[model samples]
Target: LVVRLPLYIHLIHSHIHTFSFSYILGPMLSYFNFALVSASINIFFFIAFLFQPESPYYYLMRNDVDNASKALSWLLKADEDETDKELELMRKSVEEDRQKKAGWKDLVATPTDRKALLIRFLIGFVRQFCGIIPISCYSTQTLKAAGDSFIISPDNCTIIMGIMMVI
Candidate 1:
């Protein structure tokens, strides 16, 4: 989880720079580069995922025995036929999960789960309302519009924001 923070910081830092640079491009095509860059990255990731295999559990639930066996074999580093026991266990687990109705309904059904959901919902709610997203998205334009801080480039303002975010 600690390592996850750095990754998020890096991604948000990229967003800061991308939009900061957009301000330099002025209002006409302000977000063009950022959109292009973001889209290209997303397309690359999408294509990468296209090559990846579907989850074994998904195939098993669909009753695609052949594909489920193959996926299980790949996951367990064993031959497809060797996964019979694993598949049987997965079948049992899936049946149990279905019997328990362990889906979105369960997320808020019980007292403990409801509390967990409330805590998570509040955390996400606070995160967005705490100014991080807007700051990263428009801190450059905000600095530019402020007029008094005209000496520091919008790009530099983004760097300062990024540093503050990391710290």
Candidate 2:
């Protein structure tokens, strides 16, 4: 929600400027205003993230059982019995992930690794057919083609899409 809200704000600012709605305030300088606002918001998000909870698994990895249990308790909604069980399960999953992590040689030698490689390959291949490349490269043209459906200008929409990708 935080990520998308910035894109919406950029779009709204674009609309206001395009329509000369902010002409009474000052000149319509887009990039400078957006950059200042985005930087300010990023600072706020960084502070907010500092106050957020650390993952229980992180504490477990550091061999801090007390902190890990506390984190697990919070994560499991303070359900005491479930916290221990879930923490143990998380430990097992983490160990398995560490063990399963493979190198280039293991990628083709192991069946599981080969399956993972093929899945990644297929995802990459399929994305090319999803029209993302052309829509991104020729975004103005794409927006123009879809123009009639929207009340907002295609240029503003394209600008918003760019911001969304950046965020």
Clashing pairs in 1: none
Using lDDT as the measure, the top candidate is 1
What local lDDT score does residue 147 receive in model 2, on the 0 to 100 scale? 55
Candidate 2, run of 10 with poorest lDDT = 19-28
lDDT by residue for model 1 over 19-128, one digit each (tens)?
45544443334377657866787899899979878777788778787897787777678764567888888878777877775567867888998899999899899988
Compare the candidates by TM-score and give the number of the best one: 1
Number of clashing residue pairs, candidate 2: 0
Q: Cα deviation of 67 in candidate 2 (Å)?
A: 1.3
Question: Model-by-model lDDT, in order?
Answer: 0.71, 0.68
TM-score of each: 0.61, 0.49
